[model samples]
Target: MATANGKLLTVPEVLAELGGEVARSTFYEWRAKNQAPKCIKLPNGEIRVRRSEFDRWLESRTEEAA
Candidate 1:
């Protein structure tokens, strides 16, 4: 399900949003490690992340580096 802000993003979309700085395998690794952004598993078994959550997660990472 998409948030009011925008549509839910796929793994590839999330990668593009991050400018492809991280490889797909690495992203999946992070997800497995619970270090990635929040995601939702649809009934169809598809994974998606809300744009707002992704943005928030990115901001948190930036703050962590500060």
Candidate 2:
């Protein structure tokens, strides 16, 4: 299920978008370390990442080959 533009993405959706390159545990680890993209914590305690922010974060990760 593709996330619509500007929609908020769940952990699983973000993982799928990364092609499963990173494990779910690693994602959580990143969150804990504040290394992942900014996320929203819903009132119920669920975490969500905005599509636009995720896209920006992903783009920022791009590094020119040495």
Candidate 3:
């Protein structure tokens, strides 16, 4: 999990960062499997992901072309 002090992105923002191709349901599924970037749940149950952590996560999933 990342620190909360960093910029926090909402689920929609995250999706847009992913090019607006991934559905919300699919993202939720990734969370359930713990395959997505670490997220923070606020007191009001809103989900947020740190910008740095999200960038790291995207890098982790990248595959170099052969």
Task: Give the best candidate by TM-score.
Answer: 3
Candidate 2 regions with alpha-carbon error over 4 angstroms:
1-5
Tens digits of per-residue lDDT for model 3, 17-51: 99999999999999999998999899999999999
Total residue pair clashes for candidate 1: 0
Clash count for each candidate, listed in order shown: 0, 0, 0
Q: Sort by lDDT, best first: what order?
A: 3, 2, 1
In model 1, pairs of residues that clash are none
lDDT computed for candidate 1: 0.88
Model 2, CA-based lDDT: 0.89
Q: Which residue pairs collide in model 2, if any?
A: none
Runs in model 3 lying further than 4 Å from the true structure: 1-4
In candidate 3, which residue pairs clash?
Answer: none
lDDT scores in order:
0.88, 0.89, 0.92
Which of the two, 1 or 3, has more lDDT? 3
* lDDT at 57, model 2: 95
